[model samples]
Target: MSRRRRKALPSEPVRCVIETLSHDGRGIARDNGKAQFVDGALPGETVMAKFTSTRSKFDELRAVEVLEADDARMTPPCDFADLCGGCSLQHMSGESQIRFKEDTLREHFAHFGGIEPDEWVAPMRSPALGYRRKARLGVKYVPARESVLVGFREKRNSFLTDIDRCVVLDPRIGDRITPLRELLHGMDAYRRIPQVEVACGDDSAAMIFRNMDPLSDSDRQSLIDFGQAHDLHIYLQPKGPDTVHRIWPETGEERLSYDMEEFDLTMKFHPMDFTQVNVDINRNMVHRAVEWLDIQPGERVLDLFCGLGNFTLPLARSAGQVVGVEGDDAMVVRGRENAELNGLSNVAFHGADLQADFTAQPWAAEGFDKILIDPPRSGAQEVCEYLTAFGAKRIVYVSCNPATLARDAGVMVRNGYRLVRAGVMDMFPHTTHVESMAMFERVDN
Candidate 1:
C-alpha cells in the first residue's frame, strides 16, 4: 500500500493563550486539546507563534509576535538574546527569574520527591552581569559571511550565533568577543581551532585554544601578539584535555586561584579544571555550605565528589578531620596538595568512582558524623544507600540539577533523613540552569 505523507506546517502564525512556562522557560499553551510549547514567551500572554517541530502529544513553537505582554517580562540586555542559547530567561526581570527558579525547585521537589523542606532558604544573589568566569566558547569561520564567528550556539539550534560580544561573561572577556574573532580570522589555524576555553582567576584570565591541527609560526606569533594585547594567558591543546600547554609568557605559574576569605582559604586550580563560574557567588556558596553543614570542631566529615578540594579543604578548617573522595585521580592528587599547601593536615584525599560500586573503597568503610555530597547532574543515587551505614547525623547536598536533587532527596528521606532546608543559588543568573543546596538531617536517629 502507498503511504500517506505528513501535513506541512501552517505558513502563517497561529494565536495561542500562554498558560504557564515549561521547565526551560518555554510558554505552555493548549490548542485543539494538544499542548503547544512556545519559546520566547511568558505566562498569561497571548502570542502568535510559529510551529517549529511537532510530536505526538505536544507541538514546539517559536513566538513570532506577542499580542499581549506579561507583567514579568522585560527587555533583554544582550543584543543577541533572541538567537543566542547562552541564556534563556534574559527577557525576564532578574528578581522574577530567581523567583521562577525557586518555584521550579519547589515544584520539582513536590512532584518528584513527594515532600517539602521544613525551611526554605533565601536565594543567593550577586552581580548578575559579567559574573561568568569560565566557559567553552564555540568558534566558526563561515566562508559565506567571510568572517569568523565566536560565542555560544544559536537558540534551539546547533548553529553558532553571530554575536559581537557576550554580556554574561566577565567584561574583561565578554567585551572582547569580536576582537577574538578578528584575531582568529587572521590566523591560518582558525578553522582547525574548534573551541577556546576561557577561565579566569581573581587577577588573571586564560584562554586555551583547542587546535585540531598544528599552528604555523605566523599563527603562533599572531596568538602571542593577541595574548600580549589582551593580557591573557594563552595555551594551546593539540589533542585532548591533557595535551593543553601554555604558549604565551610560558614561564611562571599557569594556575588560577580564588580566595574564600571567610574560611581564610585559597584554592589554586588549572584553567581546564572544573571551577564554579561565578566567583563572588561561589565564595558565598562555599560560606553558605559551610554554615549549613554545621561542621563541629571534633566531628569527622566525608566530602564526596570533592574537586580540587574546593569544599574539602574549607570544611577541614572547621571539622576535626575531613576525608575527600573523587572519581578523577588528578583532582584527588590536587586536593591532597591543596590540603598540604593550606596546612590542613586533618584533610585527606582519595580517588574513587562514586557512580559505580564504591563500597570496597577504604574511606567507604569509615563512619562519618556528617557528609557533604556534590555529585554531578546524575545525582548521588549510589551513595544514598550508604548514608545509614555511615551513621551520618547531618548531610548537605550541593546540586546543579534540581530534578536529580529531587530524586535523590526521595532516596535520602526513605533512608531516615528529613529535608530540613532547601534553597536555590543564582549561579547562572539569567539562565534556566539552576544550582541548589539542600540539607538533610537523620531525624529517625
Candidate 2:
C-alpha cells in the first residue's frame, strides 16, 4: 500500500484587537500560536480577519469585518482611498499616525540597538494632505471603456485606478486630474503615453508626458497650447529619465528649486530627479537633524548620501569644514553649485557610492567630529559601517524605513555606539510611510 499524505490544516477566522500599526501600515494582531499582520484595521479596535498566509511564527491576514471601530478611525480625506494604492493610513487620524510612527522608532531602538533615548523626541509633523511635490501619475487608455484612467495603481493590484483627483498630491496637480484625463482623451498619442511626471515649486508646476511614440507637430502644439492655458510647464519623454525635455517654449536649462529659510539654502534639481515629496517636512527635518548634530564652530562634519546639499549647506553654517558624499555624480555637481550659490565656502561635495565601500575615498582620510546620514529606503548599512570605521563622535541618521534602520542601528550598537535619541517625521501625511531620524554617540571608554 502507498503511504498516505498528511491532511492540511484549515485556516480559521478570528477576532483580534489591533493594538498598534506597523511601519508598513499593517495592524499588529495576535492569533492562536501566530503573530498576525492584518491590513485595513486600525488600533484600539477589534477586527475579524481571515488568515491569508501563514508562516512558522508570523501570519498575514485580511480584515473581513470590523467587529468594533476605533474612535481614531475617521473617514479618509481622499476620494480614492479605497481604490488607489498610494496611501494606506489616510483613514487613521494624523495625530494617531504620528504617535504610531514615534513608537515604531522607539521600539526599534530598544529591541534591536539595545538603547533608548533619555528625553522624549519632538515629532516632525507637516501638512496633513496635499503635500506631495513630486510624483509619477500612471496613464492607461481602456479601449473597452472608451476612456483613460490616469492616476495611481489600484489597491493590491498592478492595474491603474480610475481616479478623478488625488488629495495627497499638491493642489495644482490634484485639481488638474479631471482636465488631464480629458486632455489625454483627445490626444492622438493617448495610448502611447503611459505616465505623467509631476513636479511642483512655489512659483510653477510641471507635467511631463512619457510617451512610447513621438507626437505629431499638431499634437505637440495642442499640448503646448493647453499647458500654456493652464499655466503648466509641459515636457515630453520618449525614452528614459534622461530623455525627458521641455516640449513647449524653449527654456534651455531652467531647473526647479525649493528654498529652506531655516537652512538659508535654495537647492536646484532636475525634473526627473530624486527629491522629498513634502517641502515642509524637508525643512523641519533639516532643522531637527542640525539641532541634534549640534555642529559647533570649527568642528569637522561629514554628510553621507547627501542629495543636492540638503543637509550639507545648513551644516556648513556652523561647522568649519563640511564634506558631502553622494552616489549620483549629477547630484554631487548640483550640491557643489548650490553651496557656491549660497556662498558657503566650508562645504565640499564628492561623488562616490555610499552603498559600496567608501572607506577607500580620500575624503575618508580626514577625521570627522560629527556625521549626518540621510539614506534612501535601502538604508545606509555600508555607510554606517564606514562611519564606524572612522569612529565619528556623533552620528545622526535619517531613514524612511524603520526595519532597515533598526538593523543598521544594531550594527552601530555592536560597534560601541549608543542610540542617543530617535523620532518620527511625518513627511508623507495621510500615508503609512514612516520617516524617522536617530542620533547615536560612541560610548565613552
Candidate 3:
C-alpha cells in the first residue's frame, strides 16, 4: 500500500516546542502519555503539527506551521530540500547539525545506557555541502511524464523525486544529475535503467547504471559519449554487482580511487565498493578512533567489519600486527590488496561473518591487545560477545546509529566491558543522522 493511501486515524493538531531530536531524525514532543514525533522540525522550535498516524503509545505528525523557528535554523541551499529524501536536517545549519548530534549522543548515554563520557571529545565535521561521495540513486522512468527520474525518493514517499541537482553530493557528481537524466531519457534502454550507484574518489567520479536489459549499440555509444563529455567514469550493470563493466571511453577511467593522507593510504575501488560518504569526516573519525585506541608500537589489534581496511590499515602503522575481518569476501580481498599496495605487510584480512559463530577461527582465539569495530546500523552485538574471548583490554566502537550502539553497549556492560568514553562524529552535516565513536574497556583484573 502507498504511504499516502494508508489509513491513519486523524487527531487534533497541537502546538508544541520541539524538545529535541530523536536518534532517527524525528523531533520529540510529548502530549500526556502519547508521544508525538514531528517530522521536519528542530529542537527549541515552537511549531504546530498535525497528527497523521496514531498508535496506542505514540503518534506521527507533520509540521504545518513554524510559530517561531529556532535561531539556528536556516534556509536550505538545495531547492529540493523539502521534496528530496536525501537530507533530513536541511533546515538546520551545518554547525547546528553537529551540535544536535553531540546532544543526542550525550542524552542517549545518560538516559538509555546510564553512562557518560568523562570529557567532551571534539565533534568530527566535514564540509557542509558537496561532501557526500557515495550514494545509490533511485531511477524511475515515467512513460506518461516522458522523463526518467534519477534522484532520491520523495519525502515520505517511495516514488523517486524529480531533481535537477543536489547540493549535498560532491559537486562533480551533484552537477551531473540533469545530464544523467537526459542521457537516460534519450537512450533506447531508458525504461530499463533502474539505478545509479555513485562512488567518488579524490579526483575521479564513477557511476554504475543498473539496467534490466542489454544496451543497444547506439545506447552504448551514447553512454560512452555522455561520460566522455562530462568527464565521468561510467559503468553498466546488466545483472548482479559482479557483472558491472566499465562503459567509459578510457580504460583508465575504469578505476576510481581516494587518498587518505592521515594513514598514507590510497585505495582503488569499484563504484559499488563500501566507503564512507563523507571523506573529510571519515579521516577525522579514523584518526580519533586510532588515538582513543592508544595503539602502541608492538600491540596486536583486531578490526571488526573493517571494510577496505579503513581502520585496519591505519592501525597497522602503530600496531605490530592487525587482523581485519569482514562479512564480504570481495571487500576482504580488496582490503588485502590495499594493504599490499600500501606495503603494509603487518595487516591480514579474513572473510567471515562476524555475526555468525567465530569460535572456530584461529584469529578469534588469538589474543589482541585492542579492538576497533565499525559496524553497520544492525550493530555488532554478536561480535561484541566474540571479542570477550580475544582478550582485548580496550575496544573502540564507531557507530552510525545511537540506539543500536546503546544496545550493544548494554551487552558489553553485561560482559564486563565498561563504556569509558563516547562522543558524536558529525560525518554527515545538515542531517539528523548521527555518527558516534565510543571506547569501552574491560574491567581491570
Candidate 4:
C-alpha cells in the first residue's frame, strides 16, 4: 500500500478562546468550527497557539502567548513549566485544581455510569510542590546542545525538556537534576542511558539508570562516588526492570521503605515496585478508606490489587481478618513479607489475576464483611461482577482513573450496589491525573 502524507502544521499562530478544560488539562477551543486542543492554555482565556500536530478530527496546539487569563490562573512555579510535560495544571491554583478534579469525577460518574453518589466527600488536599516520590525521567543527548538532558519530555513532543530541576519531584532528586545531567555527560555510556527511574522513601532516595550498553569502570566508580556524596542509592539496569541491581553500597541489601505511622506500619519494597508518588496523599487516602470501610472487630475484609500490603496491613489492624489479593506473585510475596515485618498475623496475601474470572478463587469462597479495591487506570471491570459473590456489606474503591472507576461503578450498581459516597483525592498535585475513592454498599445486604 502507498503511504499517506500527513498535513503540515500551521506556520502562523492561530488565535483561540479557550472554552473549557479537557480531561488531560488541555484547553478545548474551536477554530473555524473544528476543535483544537491547546496545551498551556486555561479556560476563560484567549491565547495565541501554534499547531503542533494536525489531524482529521482536531489539531493539537501549544499556547505561545495568553491574551486573556482565567481568574483561576496563576504563574507556574517551575522555571521549565512551559516546556516540561511532567505537570499540566501548574498554572491553575491548587484550590481551583482540586475543584476541577472534583467536578471531573462527578462528570465521569454521571456520563459513564449514569449515576451519582448519595454523599460527596470533601476533596483531600496535599502540598503542591516537591511532593513526588516516584517518576520516570527521559534522557537525551543532544549534540547541538553538547549536553545530556535528564527530565520529562516536552509538552506534546518526543524531545526531552532539558530541565535543570523539576518542581513536582522530591527535592532530593529534583534539585540534583543538573548535577545528574553533568554526571551522565561525563560517562562513556551517556548516549546509551535512555531514562532514569526515581523512587524515594521516608529518608532515602533511589535512582535506577536504564543503561542500554555496558558501563565502563570509570562510569561505575563515578556513580558510586556521586551516590556517596549525595547519600543516595544508585542502581543500574542493563536491560529490564528485573536486571536492576545496586551499583553503590555494593555490600548490603538496600531495600526502600515508607512508614505509615498512622497504623504503625512500615512497607518495604524494591525501588522498581509500584508505590504512591505522593506520600502524604497516600496516607490520607488510606486513612479515609479505612474510615469509610468501618470495619468491625469481628469482620473479615478483602483487599484487591493490594501491593506491598499498603492497605491490607492497615485494614488488618482494625478488621478481624484481612486477605490481600494481587496479580503479581512478586507483589504478593512482598505483601506477605510486609505483613510479617509488621508482625501482623491477621492478614493474608494471595496472588491472582484480578482481571480474570476470580469469583472461583479460593479467597472468593470466604465470606467477608468488607472489601477494598485499588485498581489501575483500566479499573476493575472484570472483577466488579464477582464482588457480589463475596457478599460484603461495604466496598471502598480507590481509583487513579475516574473514568474507569465510574465504568466499574455502573457494573456494581447493576449488581445491586448503591454508590453511597465518593470524592476526589489530590494524590497527584498540579496535574490532570485524578485519584478518587468511592464507597459502595449492597442494597439487599
Candidate 2 lDDT, 342-396, residue by residue in tens: 9998888998867688777788787889999888898877777777777788999
Worst 10 residues of 1 by lDDT: 357-366
RMSD of each: 1.7, 3.8, 3.1, 1.5
| lDDT, candidate 3, 59-149, per-residue tens | 8888878898888888889998876778888887777777778877777766766866556677776678899999999888987898899
Clashing pairs in 4: none
State the local distance difference test value for candidate 2. Answer: 0.84
Candidate 2 ranges beyond 4 A from true positions: 1-23, 28-38, 46-67
Clashing pairs in 2: none
Local distance difference test, per candidate? 0.90, 0.84, 0.84, 0.91
User: 420, model 2: CA deviation in Å?
Assistant: 1.0
- Give lDDT tens digits, candidate 1, residues 1-445: 9899887887789998999888898889998899999889989999999988888899999888989999888989998887799998888888889988999999999998578999999999988899999999999999999988999998788899999989999988999998999999989987888899999988889999998988899999899999999999899999988899998887997787888888888889999999999988888888988998888889999999999999998899889889999999989888987887788899889987686776567766767889999999989888888667887889999999999999999999998899999999999988998899999999866
How well is each residue in 145-199 modelled by candidate 4, as lDDT tens digits? Answer: 9999999988777999978988889999999999999999999998999999999
Every model's TM-score: 0.97, 0.90, 0.91, 0.97
Candidate 4: global Cα-lDDT? 0.91
By TM-score, rank the candidates, best first. 4, 1, 3, 2
Candidate 1 local lDDT, residue 12: 85
Candidate order, lDDT descending: 4, 1, 3, 2
